[model samples]
Target: MGAITIQELTKSYGETNVLKGIDLAIDDGEFLILVGPSGCGKSTLMNCIAGLEDITSGELFIGDDNVTSVNPKDRDIAMVFQSYALYPTMTVERNIRFGLEMRKYPKDEIESTVKDVAKLLQIEHLLDRKPSQLSGGQRQRVAMGRALARSPRVFLFDEPLSNLDAKLRVEMRTEIKKLHKRLGTTIVYVTHDQVEAMTLADRIAVMKDGIVQQFGTPYEIYNDPANRFVADFMGSPAMNFVECIVFEGNLIVESGNQRHEVVIPNTQAVIDSGLETVILGLRPEMITEPKPHAESGYITQMQLGVQVTEPTGPDTLAFGEWNGQEIQARLSPEVGAQAEIDGEVQIQVDTGKAVLFHPQTGARI
Candidate 1:
């Protein structure tokens, strides 16, 4: 059975429509991530789901119960906010147990729950410490512990790890993933972090301007984005888009004084569409230093004037210009260093791996 169902969910703030007819169903134990830029209605949608904000239209369900009209407290959900809202006067244990205590859970049961959650979060030793004494990561964990101790029907996390430093954020991300594995609870996590969405979600909902642009598994979202907006949003360094003109069912690109045309094999639909101008999307990794042993296929080679190079430990990012637009290629540090000083580089383009988009609509063609 689905753990949560949102049907035609809509929310507006006076003149602004925050969410527009959003529909989603999350299965039991699934981790669904809502991701987008700021003011994209991710948080508003979350607030609606938590019953903190009344919907402008539509219905929501948790388990079998309709929760659109249900009170936040009565909905059987736990939320971990970005700001660790730990009680100033309460010790970590008390903060974690306060919810249970408020519900009049037996003292012994509350103590056991706190102990279990503390042990799981590896904060057993810090239970006696106040929130002021704990690190940011520790306080965030306590906030999480407070929610985990409840064993609610659903977990809502609104950028819970955003406040932590990069290292601690990664650690907490792994911890949350493990915690979800053990508890198997339905989770609705919201974040602007693409890495977090890619690493943690069972499926990702990419939103833009108050609408979901794409909703699919991480692999699908990454490899097959619905539109240029989604494609540009998900990847680090972003996908490089190069404008090209179609000539005799082949993509023709001109850079500087050179012009190269390559046939786009197997994508007949795009070729048959009678589109003249198209944008080619290629990931940095797909354009790399040409290897001597690389097999000959439909690969296209382009000569570029190296503009800049950034060495990011594992790989070096080489930047250049193609058809008057900036292009990036990922290459080995050794090769990148050599090209960096030379001011020129030979880049091999895997044309088969390239994606085509309509320049006007930004939709995959």
Candidate 2:
């Protein structure tokens, strides 16, 4: 009954539109992440769902009720902010019991809820401490405890881990995931961190320029992007885009004075598009050192003039140029140790995982 449904939701500020035609749904107990860069309307969309911002158009349903026009408190949603909005003077236990007390709940029931939430979040030991006395991670746990005490229909997290340090953020991320599974609560989380979205979400909605660029599972969004923007934005080092010319059912890539032909997937689709020039999208890991059994129909062996090499512990990143565009390849540490800078190395390109996009429009071909 905690499921949410949004239909063509739109929000604006006078003449400026923030969220445009957003349609999304999440089943009860699902963890949904709204992820994108700043000013992409993710936060605005979250606000609209929470009843904090009025929508210009569209319908929003939580469970079976149309709560688009309902007040924030009446919507049965709990929100956790990035800033950890905890009361300065109140003890952690008092903070968690505040909302229930305001609603005139039985004193014993409020005490039990607070104790249970504290135990679930592992903040039982810190219950008597004030917010100022706790670390960033502990304060965040308190904030989460406060939200859990309400046990609302939906939980909204607006960049909850943004203030924590890197190590603490990872720990908190795992904690949040565990909490979601244990409580079986419908969660809507917002983050600009793609890694966070990938790790924490059951489904992700990538937004940009006031519109949802793509919405899918992490694997689909990472491997099968809707457009060039989604492909470039999701990955860590980002996907490499090389300009190539389509001719005779192959993509022609040029590096220096050499020309290499790469087999294209969906030959008929590329032919039907009738676009001579296209952008080749390849993830860094797709381009790697040649293997003994790597001889395959879709594999193309090309010589790359290595310009720079970066060793990042487990894997090394090699930078080279393809068709005058700089591209990166992930190499094994052993192979990278022998890679000479400013020298040429043979690389195996996997066309099986390659994606084609229209050059001018940036549309997937």
Candidate 3:
């Protein structure tokens, strides 16, 4: 069984707390990603799980056994590091077989494991070459191959794709996904790239400031974030936040002489809270070129003064201002061109899918 359960996990260095009360669980064969910006203690938590770092207070269970005090080697887990950590002098074949040999496995079993891992990673032809002779992606594969040869209960990937180039990163990302599906092994991956977290994780634990801000499926974390930070951090272009004044059960957005009132689902709740100001959260894709007609009261049609347009192949990003804050709207190429030329364009905002946050606390209202 590869299921992992972490209860009240806390890691501290002197008076500084790195991981503050982290509690998460993953079933057997589940792929979980720990993601956050640099210095958020994601890597530290990974080290704790790998037994490289000791936890201050917590209980960690892998399958049925509590492995909190177990040595890393005895934990029955394999790790793939960001640096590849390959022995440069040894050939790929030796590197893959090193772990099995260190465990004193039979010669036939070692050879078979090396062959199987090399074949699975599609690096059989390159197995005779040293680490210095391989490309970045190949080196990463050899690193993964080394970890795979162990066939441990859980696989730990610590920013394994960070060293690869853009195109290679995407390629390796797909390969890792395929590998996970094929092996059906539990994987705990750590990365700061939310795109990687979203693409690769079965469930993601978004960490920040030594704490897990939210833990859920990619869809839940993206669409229904617990707080404003999660919403702002997860998206590429990011969620657009505009400070608006709540008036008469409506949120008001103003630009120059024009005014737009957006009706949100929780307008009454926000009004009842006696909060006069709220931050309106809208994804870039939610604001687009004006449709033929407004579907409901939640959809507001307004004129947006596009200051800049960025062409991103299929669609263009139109930048405008609303409520004294910059806003990005994803529009079709033709619409973007028109907005660029005309300076102002009609846009529709689907507030039905929009969210509201407390202006002071940045908490979902």
Candidate 4:
């Protein structure tokens, strides 16, 4: 079993703490992505898991064996770095074989292993080429091949696609997912890109300032965020948190001197929070182009003055104001066909799917 368990893991440097008591688990063959901004301790946690950094305190287990104190090479893990850390002068075949050769495997065995790994990574044609001669994607594949040849207990990827061009990064993301499916390898990938975390992770651990904000499946992290930070961090267009106040179990949303009271879903959390002022969180897609039969949702229309409309291929993003705070909504190009700066536009709202957060505490209610 390649399952991993982390218990109260904490790492510090000098007087500066990096990881603040992290607890996590990864089932065998599960793809767990560690995502957060730079200096959020994601890379530090990864180093701890790979036995490259000494933990300040806590336990880490790999398949029932505690490996927190194990040496890096003996921890049975391989890491693919963002820089595609291949030997510059060494041929791809030699780079892939270097580790096995260092372990004193026989020449014939090394040759066989290299051939199989090259075939697996589809780098057979480039095996004789130096790292400088290969493209970014090829170098990354070769780096992956080197790790794959070892057949380690776990694979740690430290933003392995960050260096590639946009097109290559997308291609590599899909390729990496395919590799995971084919090999069924337990992997812990680190990335700052939310898109990568959303698209690639079986489970995501979102961190900030050495603390794990939330940990769950992509859908849960996106839809059922624990707090405002997580909700704002996960989405593409980002969620709009409009200022609102509660009055008699209904939300009072004011726009352009006009007021609208939308019914909120009654739940225990709302009753428990007991806060009158709230921030209504809604996604751009929820505020869409009005349809003839937009009667399905808690639809409310307001004469919002449009500032600018941006067409983003699939959907157009229109900028406006809610309660005098800048807000954005998604609209169809045809529906926004006549939208202009400072023009009044009727925008629909989906209050049913809206989330409420305590304005003071920023916690979801």
| lDDT per residue as tens, model 4, 193-231 | 778999999999889899999999999998889899888
TM-score of 3: 0.94
Which regions of candidate 2 are displaced past 4 Å? 104-109, 119-125, 132-138, 340-342
User: Global lDDT for candidate 4?
Assistant: 0.85
Candidate achieving higher TM-score, 1 or 4 = 1
Best by lDDT: 3
* Candidate 1 segments whose C-alpha is farther than 4 A from its true place: 132-135
**lDDT of model 3, residue 319:** 96
- What residue runs in model 3 are displaced by over 4 Å at the alpha carbon? 104-109, 119-122
Clashing pairs in 3: none
- Colliding residue pairs in candidate 2: none
lDDT of 1: 0.88
Of the candidates numbered 1 and 2, which has the greater TM-score value?
1
* CA-lDDT, candidates in order: 0.88, 0.87, 0.89, 0.85
Please give, for residues 1-365, the per-residue lDDT of candidate 1 as tens digits. 33999999989889988898898888989999999998898878888988989999999998888988998999888998766689989999899999999988899999899998898777999989999999888898899899988978889998887767888788878988998999899999998888999999999999998888999999998888899999899989899999998877788898779998865654576677789889888889888988777675768888878999999989899999899889899989998999899998988988776778899999988
Q: Candidate 1: TM-score? A: 0.94
2 versus 3: better lDDT goes to: 3
Q: After superposition, how far is residue 147 of candidate 2 from its true place, in Å?
A: 1.3
Pairs with steric clashes in candidate 4: none
Tell me the TM-score of each prediction against the true structure: 0.94, 0.93, 0.94, 0.92
